[model samples]
Each structure stands twice: as C-alpha cells, then as structure tokens.
Target chain A: MSLKNTEAVVLSQLRLGEADRIITFLSPQLGKFKGVVKGGRSLRCKMLASTMPLTQVAVWFVEKRTSGLHLISQCDIINPFRTLKENLHKLVSGLYLTELVEVATWEVEPDEGLFELLLWGLGSLAAGERLQAVLRIFEIRLAVLLGYEPQLSFCLGCEKELAGRESYYFSFAKGGVICAKCRAGARGCKISLGSVNFLRQALRFQQEKLGRLTLTAASSKELQQILPAYLSYHLERKINSLRFLNLLNVRC
Target chain B: MLYTESLAKLVAELKRMPGIGNKSAERLALYILGLPKDEAGKLAQAILQLKERIFYCSRCGNITEVDPCTICQSPARDAGILCVVEWPNDLLAIEKTRGFRGHYHVLMGAISPKTNIGPEALRIKELQARVSSQQVREIILATSPTLEGEATAMYLYEVLKPLGRITHGGRIGVCR
Candidate 1:
C-alpha cells in the first residue's frame, strides 16, 4: 500500500535534513501527499524539475507504514508549466491555485474531484485568460467541491421570487441575498445583478468552456467582494492569498 | 537526564537553534564547557551584544548599528537608482558581487500570501517615502526570482507607476 505511481502537481517544497527536501504534491488518485527527496538540494539533482510550484510530474514513492514522510524513489517532470514561471501574472495565478489546493484538501484523503479542478485552474491560468476572472471561477468551484456552495436564490428576509435584473444585498449571516424592502441596514455588501448571473453561469460552466466565458470588470468587482465574504464565513477564516490579490488589484 | 542542571540548560538553549538536533545541541553544550572560561563568557556576551546593538535602518530597513545603514548614509552610491531586495542577506550578496553602485532598500520579506505577509506587512511605505524624497530616475528592482519575490516586484511597480511618469516593471531594463 506504500508504493505509489501517479501524475501529480507539485504544490510546495521545504528543505529537510541537509540534502533532502519534503515536497507536497496534489495527485488525482492520492489527493495530497508529502514525500522526501533525498539529495534533492544538490546541484546535480535530476528530480529538480519535478518539484516546482505547479509542475505536473510522474512520481513514484513508497509510503511508510507509520505516519511519516514517504520516500520518493523516482520523479520526472511531465509538464513544467513554463508559462507560469515566465509571466508574472501567470506566476501569481499559479501560486494562488497551488495555495488553494494546498488548503482545500487534506493529505492522502483522495479528494474526489479536486485534482481535476486544480489541473483545470492551472491550465486556464497559464493560457493567458483573465487573471481575476480565473481566480473567481476557481474560488467558486472550490467552495462547491467542498460542499459549501453559497445560496444564490431569493432574498433571505422576504423569500420573494426575486428577479435577477437588479442589484441585491448579500448578507453573510443570512447566507444569501436580502430583498430591497428588507435590506434596511443590512450588514452585507451589495452584489450586482450581472455578478449574480455570472456566478450562476460559473457554477455550471464546464472546464473547457471557462476560457471562452468572459468576466466583465463590474462582475469581477462584485464577485471579489461577495465570494471572499462567503468563503470566510463558511470556512471560518480569511484566506491570506485573497487579501494579497486584492491588494494587487487596488494598486494595479 | 544524568547531566547536571547547568549542562542541561545549555543543551536546551542550543537545541532552539535552527538545524541543531538534540545530539548536536548536546555536543555543542559539552564543547562550550571545554572552552576556556573567558572564551565561553565571550560567546555569551557576543550573542547578547548582537541583540542589543544591531537594529533595522529606519529609512531603508537594512540591519545596522547606526541610525541609518552605511549604504543609506554613503554619498558615492547613486540616489537616482534604488535597488530593492527581499532581505538583508540579499543586499550583502549584491554587495559581494561588486557590480552595483545604487542604494539598497530591504523589504524585510517578500510578498508571501500563504504566510500572511503582504505589502502592508513589508516596508512598502518606507520604500514609497524614499521614492518620493529622492530624485530617482530608474529603480533597479532586484528581488529574487521566486514567485513571492516577483509578486513583490510587480506590486511595487504597479504602485509606483501612477505616482509619476517614470519607468516601471522589473527584470532589469524592462522599463515603460
């Protein structure tokens, strides 16, 4: 049961004892796993290419019987994600995707469909799609995958059949939108009608079709405010990377 | 468990050091005991002295004993060209190469979101103040090539671009 051979995306790596490195990988079959690469820090290390932030690699490792780091016997880079390294925007997107995968999934839990989502996220990012839009999609999809899909129906207060053609108040506490009549002193941010539709479309959009779907600036801004609030409320903590990305948006 | 109380204390303190395991720490504690009394005392004094004397330069954020680091105080270095680095050690590395003649601004760390480090956490405001105070023509953004480093460079570039009609972007000579 310790032996492993699968395609994995290298998430993060940290230095271990002198010449070794402990690499975190997200594999389709294994979900997330950590293993040791002996002599990985040396100059002539052939497995060097396999451990970059978002690289797709073929890795072979033997898991220990006890709860300890597995021994990585062999690894080869299947896809280097060269574009992710070359373009600064793509690189940040890549790092964001890696961090999302790292936090969303548990180690060796075989997270159902998370590996596929990660692959799609990285592939779309490297292909030069809109950076903010790609992240929005990834964030929404990740939340859905983890079974915390935000309620996108009628207002929590009025419970009326709301038309999706106007702006509505989204409350983190009520878990969804608040009607205009009931929005008196609502403790939440406003979500545009377009963003609500975009979110619905994103939830159902296929991975291959994400590249064709465009995210307008208004929609992006609304999603930027609403999605993070939803995630923080449901996940019970704010993600640091989201804050960093928001800072970039403010400055850029 | 068999060691004397003082020896045990030394080993525990030594074990707190990075890359020092229990065995290496024990060996270091024993080694220190064998050293001359004056030398051992000197080692303890040196560690305490470093903590007391070395401080960050308020303007540039580099480690220094003086108020402003030597690089910030030197007149020979070009004030128009600022070289931003992630850490003090990076400044030392560039200094060792003997190729650059610009003043340095250490960010203390790069933009690492996973670690909860952002522009607000870094010396971004100080860097901005320096940019405004000096007649800088072209900033040499010299953060490392890692993801966080590049992100920090780009973050600075985007923030600095709107302030003036100056050149922007990092990776040496790719100004706009």
Candidate 2:
C-alpha cells in the first residue's frame, strides 16, 4: 500500500461497523474513491468534521489496492463551505452536484478539469448565486467536461448551420438539435432559439465569466428540461438527487 | 471441509447481519451449535417474540410494545417540550441521560439529497400536526451534527418556527 495525499471533496458517507465510516470522495488526482475512517462516528473524533459531505479536505491515506478500500489516516478540512450547508436549498443543491460527480466519474482515473468545475459549483452556491443559474451552468459544464458536449452549432439532420433557426427539435437520443425540416420523424422535443443561444454562450464562457451570463425565464425552463435529459441519456442512469431537488422546488 | 447443510445455512443467515463477516458468522454459528438445547430454544423464541410484539409507537415513532408508548402516555413528562431526533436509538440515548423530562419525536431518517429523501419523506408532517394540535412551547432540535442531520434540523426550524420557539442541539436556556 502506498501513501497518498490529495485535496478532495467529500461526496457521501456510509456507516461502517459500530463506529467507523466509509467516506466517498472526489479528488483532482484521484477521480473517485472510498476510504474507511476509524471511529468517525464518535462525537469527539477529529475526523468527524473533516468527513462531512461537501467539505473540501486535505486527506492522507494508505491506498490498499488489493481490497480497493483505502485507510484514511489523517484528514483536515480546507473549506467547510458553511454557508451552503446552513441553507436548506443550497445544501440540497450542493449534495446534488457532488452526487452527479460521484456517479459520472470512475475510480482512480484523474480528471482535474471536472474536479475544478465541482469546486466552482460548490463555491458559487456557498456565495449565494442564483440557484437556477448555478444548476444550469454546472450541468452544461459537466456535460462538456465529460466529452458529451451538446452539438448546439448545427442541425443534426440536414447538417445546416443553426445560427438563425427560430426553433429546433433537441434530440436526446442524438444529443443535438434538428431543424424544422428534419423534425418530421425525429424523436425530440421543441426548444426555442433563445435557449439555444444562451446555452452556446454558456458553453464558450470562461469559468470566471460564467457567472456574468444570466438565464432568461424561457431559456431557464428550456435548459431545465434539456441538459438533465441529455446527461441522463449519456450517463444511462436517472440522477436521484434531481428528483430530490424537484421536490424542494415544488415545496417553495 | 464443507459444513453440513444446516450449519452452512446458519452461517449464511448470520452473515446477513450488519458488521458480521465470514469469520464472525462462522464463530457465532459454532457458538450457537454448542449452546444447551433449552438455551438455544429460548433464544429462538425471544427473536420470534421481538419481531411479533415490537413495533413503532404511533404517536412518536419510537419502537415500543404499546400504541402511544410509555413516555407519551406518562403524565410526568412535559407535553409542551418536545425533543426531535433522527432515529429511535437517539431517543434511548437521551432517555438514558435522564436529564430531560420532555416527550420525544423520532424522524426515522434525515433529509439526504443523495438518497433522494426529502422533508416530505421524513416525519416532518406528523411533527407539524403534533405541534399545531398540541400546546407545544419549545422544540429541541436534537438531530445529529452530520451534514444531512444539520440540513434536516434547518428545514425543521423553518417549518416549525411560526409554531413555537425552536432551539438546536437540545441546548435549553441558551436563547437563540
């Protein structure tokens, strides 16, 4: 077993044995991994605070390659993002973001870009950015980072440039838009050109400039339907946290 | 050497328990096999009795053999002060301290977005019902200190704020 130290964000934790816990985390160097923390459930354990989900932590662990479960020796919280956890809506959004990362990633395969994007998402929520804007940006950027970037530039059916299309059919199965002429037999949903333009800009914006891009009501509604379906199509699984977020929105 | 069918079945069944590994399951099976016949019979009967008689108290969601539970039915306990916890074991832990004389409400679980469980999936509605119908004066948010637990506590505070005064972590007399 080799010793490794990396900055990771806690994804989720499960109770192990009587007082131990199995913590899953996402790291820049290690895509996703699970580590066993001894006595994590104890009220006075130092690991208690560091192991909480969505907390950015610096962890030193022994990688047990044979068993596939690392042993976390020491972990220190880098940033607790306390504000995100203090608000219910923000907390749910944070959990949903982490859960998506955890589900989309594979173990031990490093993806620094995705890791940075996750930190940005969590930081934005903690800083009190608009919730809808944060969710849409995170989803679009996540799709791009994972190589499932939506084909927003052209119509898939006739290979025509989609610069001035009034409306288009976004095919979840094809992962792009189909023009009106191509819509006869296409299995897709109609989306407005305004939503398309906003998404295209979102995809090209730098991380720092992403916040400056705001979503119109129509675009927000369109994206709220499109990106998730696109990601779910590519990832081949229903993201459970999205359902939880929907419930919270309904309550509001 | 392979164990007989009966021994293997016992080992398999024991392994299904939490924290029980193959070694522990085998050891426990052997210990049970070596017990006196009458003792073994009594143990089996006790397990059957537990599953048959034990159930959650309708009022507070705590496990009990009775409907309202002894704590709920007791006149000595304060109905106005309610201690809300994440699970029944938490209720027992606080009860063991014998410091608080208030009744309890077990939420059964916390709000965990990863698991897709929201406030509606918890005991929050029943809690609201209890608070509106009763003369509750103070609610002690004794949920755990974990992320999910804290979120659940915050959600509860928002929902129960207009109903009465809500204090966190059971720290009474420390005004918020």
TM-scores across all candidates? Answer: 0.84, 0.91
Give candidate 1 regions above 4 Å deviation.
Answer: A1-3, A14-20, A38-49, A85-90, A151-161, A164-189, B71-81, B98-102, B135-138, B160-170, B173-176
Across A41-63, the per-residue lDDT of candidate 2 in tens digits comes to 89988899999999999999999
Model 1 C-alpha lDDT per residue in residues B82-173, reported as the tens digit of each score: 88889999999899999999888899988877677878888999888878787777677888755567678777876676656544333442
Q: After aligning candidate 1 to the native by TM-score, how far in Å is the CA of B14 from where it should be?
A: 1.2
Best by DockQ: 2
Q: lDDT for model 1, please.
A: 0.80
lDDT of 2 by residue, B1-176 (tens): 48999999999999999879999999999999999999999999999999999999989999999999999999999998889999999999999999999989999999887777878789999999998888877788889888888888878877776765445543221122
The ten-residue window of minimal lDDT in model 2 chain A covers: A160-169
Candidate 2, clashing residue pairs? none
lDDT of 2 at A191: 84
Each predicted model: what fraction of the native A–B Cα contacts (within 8 Å) does it retain?
0.49, 0.86
Q: Residues A24-70, candidate 1: write the lDDT tens digits.
A: 99888878989899898775787876776689899999988696588
